[model samples]
Target: MEDLWQAFVNVDSAGNITGDYSGKNIVAEDPYDFFFLVDKEVALSLHEYKVHLDGFKPSLVPKQSAE
Candidate 1:
């Protein structure tokens, strides 16, 4: 028997996201369902690993010359 790996995204109750890699092989009874499962797992992982965006501002400002 061979082992397979799958990627997943975990979400917490606080709406936090995290990425995870599992070593479980999902046996899809239906061929069509196989792709769906894979996609769902991947999406979850991505959501978990989402990045945070902080406030940003432009630093380019015109300087006034003192008479």
Candidate 2:
């Protein structure tokens, strides 16, 4: 996360805002929650969830799933 934060922002010996907005929502969001989706904390695996999502390809999930 620190490496990701460094990519979005830059600071010298003293801290300061030093990045371009470029229409990204970084200005209003908390960085701590930036990488997580809201449903990630839900109490079920994808197999147990009934909703049929269009783009949730299981073939690609293993590369990123910590579990």
Candidate 3:
């Protein structure tokens, strides 16, 4: 099971919005429900979430080879 999914939106200087998910076009007129699930109970929108993991830097640990 995948725990995370992401979508990126792009807009040019002309204010043209563009995005795609899984190779399909993103529709701006569609109703988008961005939310967060906590402890299998609470819920929050994309803006309401407290912690943003994406901004954090990754660890420099080297991968262990199984060979």
Best by the TM-score measure = 1
**For residues 16-36, could you state the per-residue lDDT of candidate 3 as single tens digits?**
223222112334454322222
What's the CA error at residue 50 for candidate 2, in Å?
43
In model 2, the worst 10-residue window by lDDT is 32-41
Give the winner by TM-score: 1 or 2. Answer: 1
lDDT of each: 0.32, 0.25, 0.26
Winner on lDDT (1 vs 3): 1
TM-score of each: 0.22, 0.18, 0.18
Candidate 1 per-residue C-alpha lDDT over 1-67 given as tens digits, one digit per residue, 9 for 90 to 100: 3333444334343323433333356543322201212344443444333322234321111122111
For each predicted model, how many residue pairs clash, with residues at least 3 apart or on different chains?
Answer: 5, 0, 0
Worst-scoring 10-residue span by lDDT in model 3: 58-67
Residue pairs with colliding backbones in model 3 are none
Quote the positional error of residue 55 for candidate 3 in Å: 17
Candidate 3 ranges with C-alpha deviation above 4 Å: 1-4, 22-67
- List model 2 lDDT by residue over 3-66, tens digit each: 1221122222222223312121334343421121223222123232222223643121221342
Stronger candidate by lDDT (1 vs 2): 1
Against the true structure, candidate 3 reaches a TM-score of 0.18
